[model samples]
Target: MENHNPPQLGNQLCFPLYVIAKEITGLYRPFLDELDITYPQYLVMMVLWEKDGLTVNQIGEKLYLDSGTLTPLLKRLEAKGILIRKRKKEDERVVEIFLQQSGKDLQQKACQIPAKMQEKLNLSSEDLLELKETVQKILNKIQK
Candidate 1:
């Protein structure tokens, strides 16, 4: 007969990953607060900053979010005058997101966040790169 032990929290890989994700997001909180945005909002802004005029569906796909979760975030940003959501004339169903001048200006301030986070983390460049690569690999495998 084979015997199996019950699962233990400490022995699970997910616990540390969950903790790390939460802690890292926590680390970004103060910085994000200064911009009057949250981590998820910052992620959305980052995507828009990289390329403007993306449809809401495109944004959701890139962020691994759904319309239900993303719609409110977009609405909030629009209310804050950071972005604008416009419906395409050709296709009313297509909602595109564009940065307002304020959003573009926000990018100037946000440019410093990465360096600040790096300083706060105190991880060597090599270590940071390795960690990012490892996480990306894991994420890729999970997605597959």
Candidate 2:
């Protein structure tokens, strides 16, 4: 005989992950609000910050974001003068993103966020390392 029971939140791994993601993004809210960008937009800016002038497709790949989601985010950042999106001269079909002067300046303001967030979480360096490792393991498994 087969027993059937509905799954509960306590037994589901995804529920906790979802809640944690939401809470963490919430934690970023005030900081990001001051920067005048959402978390997703912040991610895009970070990608560009590390490497300026990346093609849209490359940015999408790095962020694991699709064009549909990335395009609007890029457009919003462009509208805010944080970034500039331009079609490649050699290939009009390809768009590249570059950090504007304002965007570059924003990076200076954004650098403090990591320390602030660490203080907010009140997690020791060791604890943070362990948590990062565990999460990366799970993420690797999911990717695999």
Could you list the CA RMSD of all candidates, in the order they appear?
1.3, 1.5
Q: What Cα-based lDDT does every candidate model obtain?
A: 0.97, 0.94
Q: Which regions of candidate 1 fall more than 4 Å away from where they truly are?
A: 1-3
TM-score of 2: 0.95
State the displacement of the C-alpha of residue 118, model 1, in Å, after optimal TM-score superposition: 0.9
lDDT of 1: 0.97
**1-144, model 2: which lDDT tens digit per residue?**
875998888999899989999999999999999999999999998999999999999999999999988999999999999999999999999999999999999999999998899999999989999999999999899999
lDDT of 1 by residue, 3-94 (tens): 59888999999999999999999999999999999999999999999999999999999999999999999999999999999999999999
Give the C-alpha lDDT of model 2: 0.94
The residue pairs that clash in candidate 1, if any, are none
The TM-score values for the models, in the order shown, are 0.96, 0.95
